[model samples]
Target chain A: MSQTDIASRLGWVAVDWGTSNLRLWAMDADDGILARAESDLGLNKINDGGFETVLRDLVAGWLPDTLSDDNSISVIVCGMAGAKQGWCEAPYATVPARPETLAAGAVKPVLKQAGLDVHILPGLCQVDDPDVMRGEETQLVGFMADHPDFAGWVCLPGTHSKWARIANGTISGFRTYMSGEVFALLSQQSILRHSMQGADDAAAFENAIRHISVKPKELLHCLFGIRAGGLVSPDGQQAGAGAAILSGYVIGSEIADIMARLGRDESIALIGAGKLASLYRQALHVHDFDAEIIDAESATLGGLRRAHAALTKS
Target chain B: MSQTDIASRLGWVAVDWGTSNLRLWAMDADDGILARAESDLGLNKINDGGFETVLRDLVAGWLPDTLSDDNSISVIVCGMAGAKQGWCEAPYATVPARPETLAAGAVKPVLKQAGLDVHILPGLCQVDDPDVMRGEETQLVGFMADHPDFAGWVCLPGTHSKWARIANGTISGFRTYMSGEVFALLSQQSILRHSMQGADDAAAFENAIRHISVKPKELLHCLFGIRAGGLVSPDGQQAGAGAAILSGYVIGSEIADIMARLGRDESIALIGAGKLASLYRQALHVHDFDAEIIDAESATLGGLRRAHAALTKS
Candidate 1:
């Protein structure tokens, strides 16, 4: 279909606007994705009051040329785009709360564009332990949509990985680990960078996970060991062993901590895609906890659809 | 005195050249300081074969104009300047060995300057555990010089902090923690940076230390708490509380691990100066361990003097 045809068929828009990027999906009346678009202009890059302009420009092709209230498209946004510094602040809805009811807490941002009707979803917050999540709440909503009675933990691995507890169709609480960011900084910026130049080694990764699992307190010591290992026997180790060990040590530490708190009796719903998901799955296996990988994109879209349905009804 | 007068009185030079900076102390026959100099031209900045020129330029004023073998000055160097990529490779002296005997493993680099006899002190390494320390071994020697029979732990805090076991006049083993570096990366480079601004709070620091001590496995979770605490109660927290909490958490985790591995029955000799030393001392006190602060400069100079005396005798 041409741009006009897709625009005529578009019933609404879905956006996952995060810290570093923006993703959009054009949905038809039946909730089918008619078209999709994305940009690097995430929350971090936009200036004050520039969000609407950026969004309008990005979705202009998906909107009908004729301007009227009846033709205005509903744009549902999730993630940091609803943060205080985002396009317009959508205050956090405190838990324990059902993800489907999050639409009640959503805020509508007034737009200068005539054909765009935007609703930003509220993130979740836990006051007692002091924790928060934006984008992952929608992912949880999507996961719950498929498995309405699912319980236990959901692990979303990323720069700041989130591990959430779900029971009775509501998120009880969650914890965020800076493990992914820490890994990047250690591998690319720290002294360990020198030792981490080789390709990935599965054996080295698994061994490091086991090592950290047995002695989790020696994390800092283990990090320095990567550098010292290369120094002591410069020619003895296999290529890429350092990188693999560093990755294993970081992810292993995160998993180890979670296991220590929750135990490894129940399997985890690992909600992510690509290499990060696979790595978390492998790391989870090291702890003898089976992980079922779920597609992140599908969850995000399903979440937007659920929220959109709730918005239309109310 | 004039430059020439100081140069004439100079008996030898003691150097501590680390990865990021260089420090030199000119000494008389009695090991009394004649003059001192420093440069930002550390090991990281100097290219291969350029160490000689940088050192010569920094210490040119401290050396006599007339060059002769009779007036040859012995330059005792320690730290990363003696690493594999340094001016000369001073191979590591394995532990379970006295720091005083480190001079035996010192490597002499062939230099272009005729009046300078340079000996780079060897670092300490542990093969089994895979750990290494360059300049710190000299500091250990210095501490030993002052308290020859003192048997306890010596904590040298820095970007990479070292905690060593001292018994039988030998360093049995040591562990290095990258706590300081991790703190820097998180407070200045990570998402926590935004919430870390404000004055230092002692109470907040101590409270965070106690919090981490109770739930050590929740370290990664505690890190993200710093950010969430700011987000949830943005107006309630004291200025600089986030920074204090972050500092407390990172250092507390390191100290907690040490306490877990080795009980807190013995007092520790803390060898460092400035804010970092005081911070570590405070953190150590929180664990009910008394810390005796020893000036880092005094220890480095004393260690170099011990090494120099040994070199002259040999």
Candidate 2:
């Protein structure tokens, strides 16, 4: 749609501003998508006072020419943009709390943009074990909106993967793992990098996941094996085996750890898309736990819309 | 001693040429140290056909006035200098084999230096488990020279830490862990780097070791905690606590894995020096395993001398 059409039809904007990237979606009165935008200007890239400018530039085409509080567009944001180091600090809401209620803890940064009423949603924190999640909370809120009576485990795999527990429309607790980040570091910078120059093999990946799932203590040893395997075993020098093994080992260990802590009896809702989500689904299947794959983008958008609805009602 | 006196008294040279540095000891016929020299020209730094020149430059003063094959100085070298990528290819000696027999597999790299007869020692490998070590074998040989009949487990802690099973003067098997490398990457390159900005705390280190030792499955989670602890727990942000926890956790996990695999009954000889050795000792003590701390330099030198003695006899 053209700028004038979008400006006339647009009701509000939904955003998921994370550590490395920013995403925005324009929505109509009935939560119908009007347009979409994104930027590499994540929380880490933006300077102290640059967030407002970046946001303004990205959404410049979608904004109406006139400016007033009464005609302001509601801008609901969820993720690291709400962090202490973000555009405006949105203090975390401690759990055993309802995801919908997170909208109430949202904070607004004073802006010179006359027609932009921005609300940055709060994250969730667990005091007992000391864990926190920013954007994933919004995903959870979105997931909960679709399955209001959903009570099980929600696994969101990424750089800092989070496994959250939801029961009776409330998130009980969650734990984060650095599996994805560690995998990238080990395969890119560490000695294991040499061995990882191959295409990913599914069988190798599955075998690694299973092996680590059973003998989690052998993690460090197995990591060295990736490099050693190339030197000593002929098959290990194959095109994609090493990369597969590394991916499998890291993901498997994460699953094994969560299973050990929370038990495997509970159903898992794997929230992610693309290869990572598929890998997690495959790994969970190896452990005899069938996980239902949930689309991450949908969850983010749904959660933002729900939060916006809550804010409007309040 | 003067160069003239040292050259007159010098019998043979013992060298430990590892990946990052090279150390040379001028010894008399009776194995008495006459003089010592070192260089940063390790295997990794030297280009093709550069080893002989680097070695010659470092030991020029030790060479006698007259040069001939009969009067040439015997140069016994160990470590990565013998690998396929090193100065010359010295094929690995597979276990269950004696460390002293390592010299029997040593390969001589042809050199134009008239007064230098260079012999590079072979490393040890475990074909079954697919693991390899180069310089550490020399340390084991030196250690075995002192405790010939000693039969137990030997722990060599460094970049690639090795745990070997020694019985009847032979290394039956061994496993390598990239704990030190992992710790370095996580603390320096990973997100955890921000949290690891304090002095070493012994108590926090020990606590992390103990925690991971028992709950080894939580390795990834605990690693994330080092960062999260800083954010949520006030004490986590305390100086040195994060560093201590990271160190303790990594070391503890290594010790825990070795214990789980080998059982905690056998005696452990911790072969290292300085802070790393001390930390390992403290960690072992926490597990009720009293490891005998052996000076690493002595072990390396001793091992070189023993290998040299074997070479001379052959």
Candidate 3:
């Protein structure tokens, strides 16, 4: 095969380290993932000195096979691994750093070891509003790889949901919402969680979307009613779920706000895992936009690999 | 001294018992509050069995000597004391029930000790939807007492901010915003609380209100920037006060919805302690309407006594 294939079969290791879990992917040089190792050893568990050892043990086997004569392996990283608690808070590279211009940043790889080189990609950020991000950073690279002419809004929905306004092969501005995290906390952990059971009841949720999307003004008042709805309700068990309905109500209202601001003509793409993207797609369609959901993991993997390839060449 | 004084004093004992504090005002033959006792024995402390004992100790000295001569001395009670955790969960009187009507159908009070007469006013509620009020019941009654000819909206700002519409002497509808509670929790007890040191910065808060009232739409994006406003700010102590700004933003937005629905002609009156009422009046005026902030403690005391008098007459 090609040099990329050789690298693919023995692909360098990639890590999607999040707040709770660390997912490791081994890909061939051709950019195809071969084997994967995952663990609950996320940044949260690294405790004090355990990050290196934990990550070391998780990928101890996959590393050797991926190395080439160049004495280096293409290691791409993303997610909270860049946070203070992460494996290492690799700094972010400001905008205008294209796939070709992206940097091959520093990584604190396992020490006292040999035969491997690591390339952790820098996160993309807006200078004016430095705290916001486009996780589609790498994904945009992959998106660009797939559709060189692609430009518009690339919406990434997750724990901290991100919406990026993409233009001219570059991401210009983006905003983040605690949408997914808020959903989880309100739906399962918050006091409103239990009352909203059987949320799988699509009919109830559909009816809810309609209610919130149309009368956004009623959202705040409707939320407090969640508890009251349960108090005077014939179905006491539905109280928590009804409270969650308020969760959906708030989310739907926020989405409606974004939709209105984005206007009708811009292209909307829902980028994330299936279920989340699907939900956003459904919410967006109400505004008459046909949005499609993209697999976040794949986008992340492709995006990272492309960045590594571009930065090394540059 | 006067007709209103006679009605206020000799009516009966009026009590507002909540989770944290217990307040009781004893009216004389003239409906003037002859004696008042406030105690730390809030319902939260009663657990399961001591509600009666705690309440008795608070009011034993204030009880009228002539009480029980015929039917014993009657009292009107409201607030969380009538909730499930209180003496008894006085059933909610669905919407359209005035203070006079709700007091008439209070739950049957159980006598735990010798020579004790007590009655708990039921909570006011909405039947078509699920919302209830206990303390505000007295406030609404008091509002009517003070402004016998008043019509339109009365805004009560506190832990739970309430906006009630009164037309033709009846409360037609109301909406509750958790703005006050949200402010307390975020600025006092939450993770954000630690990040903020809003200590003694009324100036920051006042300036924030001006900003919010001036450009209302900044609310959607400003939430995330709160951290930046203070952290990246030269003023560390002012960071905490940012919540006040956020509080103003949310409250202002809520008022916008109300003003839009009612149009400018509706007279908006503020009924509460002066400082709290002033904050709301400014928020309302920013949206282009003048609001009158009325002293409410006396009115509420007057209201509870009025209800007790009406009950005794009935």
Best by TM-score: 2
TM-score of chain A of 1: 0.96
- Write the residue-wise lDDT of candidate 3 on A1-314 in tens digits: 44344343674677777667878887777767777778887676777666657766776666555444467665667766665555666666665555654445535555445545555555665545423442456666666566556566777876666677766666666665545544554455434444564444444445566776666556546656665666676475444367336546655765765665584456777767666677777667656778766677777777777766665565
After superposition, the stretches of candidate 1 with alpha carbons farther than 4 Å from their true spots are A65-67, A263-265, B2-8, B58-60, B63-67, B263-265
lDDT of each: 0.88, 0.87, 0.64
- CAPRI-style quality class for the chain A–B interface of candidate 2: medium
Q: What DockQ does every candidate get?
A: 0.71, 0.79, 0.27
Q: Give a tens-digit lDDT track for model 3, residues B150-225.
A: 7788888877677788867778777776556545544554334544545435565555556644444344344444
- Say what the interface RMSD of candidate 1 is: 0.9
lDDT of 2 by residue, A35-129 (tens): 98988999989997898899889998998888588879899999999888999999889988896669889999999768898999999887776
Q: Sort by lDDT, best first: what order?
A: 1, 2, 3
Clashes per model (N, Cα, C within 3 A): 2, 2, 26
- Which whole-number lDDT from 0 to 100 does residue A250 have in model 2? 90
Give TM-scores for every candidate, taking all chains together and pairing residue i with residue i. Answer: 0.95, 0.97, 0.83
Q: Which 10 consecutive residues of model 1 chain B have the lowest summed lDDT?
A: B259-268
Could you tell me which residue pairs clash in candidate 1?
Answer: A198-A240, B198-B240
Q: Give the TM-score (0 to 1) of chain B in model 2.
A: 0.96
Fnat values, candidates in order:
0.59, 0.71, 0.19
Docking class of 1: medium
